[model samples]
Target: MSSTETVRAGSGRAGKRRTPGRAGRAHDTREAILDAAERLFAERGVGEVSNRQIGQAAGQANNFAVGYHFGTKADLVRAIVRRHTAVTEELRVRMLARIAEPGDLRAWISCLVRPATRQLDALGVPSWRARCLAQFDTVPALRRIVVEESVATPSMGRVLEGMFRLLPGLPQEVREERGDMSRLLVVHTLAERERALHAGERAGTGWEATAAGLVDALAGLWPAPVTTRPLPG
Candidate 1:
């Protein structure tokens, strides 16, 4: 081969190697942005965090790193939520498949509660995801993103379906009310536990015990008797 042709071939090989390295760096940068954003958003409310702040926390010299990688603040929140949902979803799906009895309420409830707790446990100490989600739950715009990205998943749908099937006679209004209540209980409880753990305070048992406690509480909450009262005049 001509010397110029050999040089071009070598250049082609170098370009191929460099392309993957660049892509890998971009991936790492995006992950760093997400980690920084998650912690910041958890500590402060979502409304108080900015893209520039996230970029700075991610160690980017350029202020535009966050915006370039994740676009708006809402988009960034969704990305953070999505990062964990993929793992939690896999856990839920596996748990759902292993149910020995579909009619068992506790089993169905376990499917709902344990997957999240297990995910948090796997994430280990000082994790920000649970607290971050709790913050998102309070923001109207960001709450919608959470619902669309996390709560509306197929595994979650199956969990609700199994639970509702066992409560076939439950009043629709009461069921909806309890559903919202369950969400509040789960989100805040996990967030509080996460905070306590981060602060070096005891969380009153490990993640498994915490999951069992939540399961027991939710099982009672879901089936509690409702009394009829006259409407206020």
Candidate 2:
């Protein structure tokens, strides 16, 4: 082939390759970016990492990764929140299906906590994710996503609502107050214990051991109101 013809052929191939038709590749790239962001954010803190850093962690060739896929840092935060929500949803479904009739509040609450605690156990806060969740409260965009998607999503809320119903009767204000505290206690314990375990403290025995201890501690905040059994009618 003539040199000019060879050059033209190569140019045509290059143009075709650059036609921006990599839907699957784009999807995979986006997924990788979020995975890295979550790992980093959970380990470090959202403020400690940048989009360029996230791209690097994801093994991306370009530094403009998060922008290319998610458009903004806040969007990337939402993406991570969505991933957590997805895991929570899977557990929520299991809890919903498994909670027996005449459900014990403690047992039902366990269903919600057990799966998520597993995620926390497996995660090491990886610097990025730890930092991110730590700073997560100050980030308006990210905070909203965390509460709406990651925290109070429907299934979990319903579980909490049921627990509220079974709670020892308190004034409306107190019930609401304690209800929120009880749920937060579970989340707080999971995060705090995970942090401790990451700091090299041994988690007592197995998961049941650790979780049972937590259950016992948090259970103290919620007690059934004691009253005299009414005489038979």
Give the best candidate by TM-score. 1
Q: Report the lDDT tens digits of candidate 1 across residue range 186-208.
A: 99999999998988889567889
Candidate 2 lDDT, 84-166, residue by residue in tens: 66776887777777778635767756755676666655554432343345456556666677677666777877776766677
lDDT for predicted candidate 2 compared with the true structure: 0.63
RMSD of 2: 9.3
Model 2: weakest 10-residue lDDT segment is 4-13
Question: How does each model score on lDDT?
Answer: 0.85, 0.63
Root-mean-square deviation (CA) per prediction? 7.4, 9.3
